[model samples]
Target: MGDILLRVSSSIKTLIPFRSVCKSWYQVLSDPYFTRNLSLLISNDYSGKTYLVQVEKDLISSPTSYSMKDDIDCSSGCPIGSCHGLLCFERNNSETYIVNPVLGSDDDLVIMLPSMNTETEVPSLFPVRIFNLMGFGFCPNTNQYKVVRTIRSTLRVYIYTLGTDDSWREIEDLPTDRFTSCLPGVYLNGALHWLTYPRIESDDRKLEIYCFDVETEKSHQLDLLPQLLQGRNNLDGLKLGVLDNCLALYIKLGGCFSNFDIWVMKDEKCWANIFRISGVAPLSVWNRDRVEPLMLTEDGNSLIAYAEEDDERRLLKHFDVRTGKNITNRTLIEKGTITSGRRYTAHVATLMSPKHIMKRSTCHV
Candidate 1:
């Protein structure tokens, strides 16, 4: 029964209320693995996920109305990424924070990360990563969570392990400084992959992506490209996101019209066409305005997306993925919330204590 309660609970908010139902509910919530398992469940389900609206003061952030029950007052931080129920915040250009929103509305759950370098914020080469190349990932092997950042101009990589490392440690830099800030650090299979900058020096045969393993702390390359991408106008449409806890590549490909095909990476090597949309939906276009629900739904037939209008306004849109059929479209996300400089991503509130990831008696970094 304890295991069943753990499985059925969607979010930390939902799971907590069940504690009053029975002792089994309380025990499940109290388990040391509760937050960790809850984070895993959210990744697997992807239904109760919240699209972060913006980060306010104290690194406290706001999610869409669907997920905004807790009014947290935080400031001076921008979102880096979200992983395992923790929101990564970049503040003051150098310091990073790991915050667990499920814990409550105060700064008690905030874990201040060590400064990477004295380097100031890199100027905006493109829209994203005006700060730096940053990502947050979970290593399932050792049950560890790590934050990875790369100095924008130098291409040098640094890593910080929660519950273990007291300071940020430098790692080997990428072979080339050319990397796309489009989809910064895409976490998958205990590793983070960064899409290389397209068409460097006009050498455009095919660009391979850079992969860094969290557990191994080493970098490698993955040739996970499809033949359709060889002659595409812009590689921006070919986006990478997590679906069913796997690396999913969705791009506009040839069909009767421009069709969007979602390919999932299997065994870390092969790509399988698991979902296909008959026509391109405007919301599915990936560009400066990051699209929410980045991929197809679990059923592989529908996608809930945010459509950007001509007046530079975004609207909540629901439509069929395969046929470009519109179900409904309206303004769901609040106005003035999803703005520039704020990185909006999906979030699942978790009770996972940020301190629990620490390995030492005291945090030095």
Candidate 2:
């Protein structure tokens, strides 16, 4: 009975209802060991199939819509990060939230972070500052979900524990003098990874990888493969993402180069060039516009790229990385349609409950 239910709980949709069968079932499902194992199972079972969540006018009603607010200010608000079945959104550089879109409800699980502008007795400049980087990740050691916000102007970083009364706590300043990229951080292996530029300017501005541990709340630099930085003078036209459970770098070449190179960090020290798409398909079809790599298919053979046909239209195209051939392309949205916002990332559904994760907090507010 319990074992059978656990086996079928690979899908979050099924796990949700199974927990409500009775008190005993709920207890069994809520066990930390059970939840951890279930999360791993879910991750393995659904490694492919990334969702392109569009923020539309009627966000609550649209299946593709993930924005919590129907009238959210898209100019100021955007999906900053996703982790452990939760999405973090920031608005006007002050308001932040963590939401589970699959749950389809904002009543209990939705965490509204304290205003980034709130004043304190010793407040110096944060009240007048704006955060440029935000990320969300789960700390497996603490069994907690945390939101990390960085104020690039001041080199200040703050961490907020979800589902707790604890307010935001400022962490140590980033070691690097320069700020992070406009792109969101990639959460993997209990850490949030970002590409950052150095403060001291050079003829050729190089970028470094910075990672923050969710549990330790510490920041460190990650060395890149020498091959990755050989010809690249700057970080422009490069994006960071997770592929096959590892950190991946998508480098888009320019000036007569049509295809982008995909490099995966095999370990902390080694990078492997897993895929390179060259020739006609992408270069000819996409022209010079940027084509963002969303995610690889479950089979790991095909890769999906998002391309903008024009200001009014966008399309998602699949390519066979092995043969550098275009597999298929589909219209992402219609023309002249104003969605609440548009963002894409790799997502993995999990049965880990936020309420349960934050239930045994030992830290004081």
Candidate 3:
């Protein structure tokens, strides 16, 4: 029975129910060895799928059109980060949640995070303000899932371990200058990476990557490629994502130039310009300055993107990386307005449970 279940673990849909069959089956599915092998198999064999989470204008309810029937309603918050099929949301700027939206019929597993006092005093007219950036990721070394948050005003960082009694532990301070964007962090290679700018004293203002290792609770910086640094003024047009298990940067060259460039990090210090799409209409027509690279196609030939036009129409396009052309005529999403805080990211469902991975210590009061 265990061997049969292992064979079917490749499909996320099948693996979910398999764990519910019996106590022994649940244990087998949650085994560390089985979880690691299953993740690799899905990455190699599964064709990636993209889903859009739309937060209503009310800023409370969010209905996701992930599938025809999968509806996620968080009346208090908006989703900000996605990792390993778990969605992390920030509600009222004071609390957070980690939820698995695809667990059909079985009530959604929602983990409410303990509130933290992030308020700090600024010199402005409004003396007290709160600025926070949060990220969610899985740490393999400890087999635990963690949420990392950085308070911008004080540069203080806090980490919350899922299924553990630890509320939020203060970690090392962020070493970089104030991060320019409030964007969610991208999880890759057991770390969370965010785009940030250097301090005002520095002459070069081009954006750099700020990476935080989940296991070590440490921070590092990755410099931008020479080509990107040349156009420092256009930093707002840049976005980051993962492609083929590597870090990728998507930059839209606006104005008369109607195309965008995709650069993939080949090594720690090397970046390869993989694709350049020319004659892209959405680049010129979009009210938003940047377009996000969602995922690489199954065959690894085309790249999927999400962009918004001047009229606020959201578009999902498929660009053939090899030919640098928009090959697909069909629009994945039409006449849809993406909500302000709602995020759409690549999610591959898995049976790896946070409860099983997180080690319990003392309970929080």
Write the candidate numbers in order of decreasing lDDT: 2, 3, 1
216-292 per-residue lDDT for model 2 (tens digits): 88888887656545222346556788877899988765555456788999888888888877631222222434466
> What 10-residue stretch in candidate 2 is worst by lDDT?
40-49
Better of 2 and 3 by TM-score: 3
Stronger candidate by lDDT (1 vs 2): 2
| lDDT of every model, 2 decimals | 0.56, 0.59, 0.58
The per-residue C-alpha lDDT of model 1 at residue 234 equals 47
The lDDT of model 1 is 0.56
Error of 3 at 23 (Å): 4.7
After superposition, the stretches of candidate 2 with alpha carbons farther than 4 Å from their true spots are 1-19, 23-76, 117-131, 151-153, 163-165, 227-233, 279-288, 311-313, 333-341, 351-353, 360-365
The regions of model 3 sitting more than 4 angstroms off are 1-19, 23-68, 104-108, 118-132, 151-154, 201-203, 229-233, 281-291, 308-315, 333-342, 351-354, 359-365
Please give, for residues 242-280, the per-residue lDDT of candidate 3 as tens digits.
888899887775564477788989877999999987754
Candidate 3 lDDT at 341 equals 30
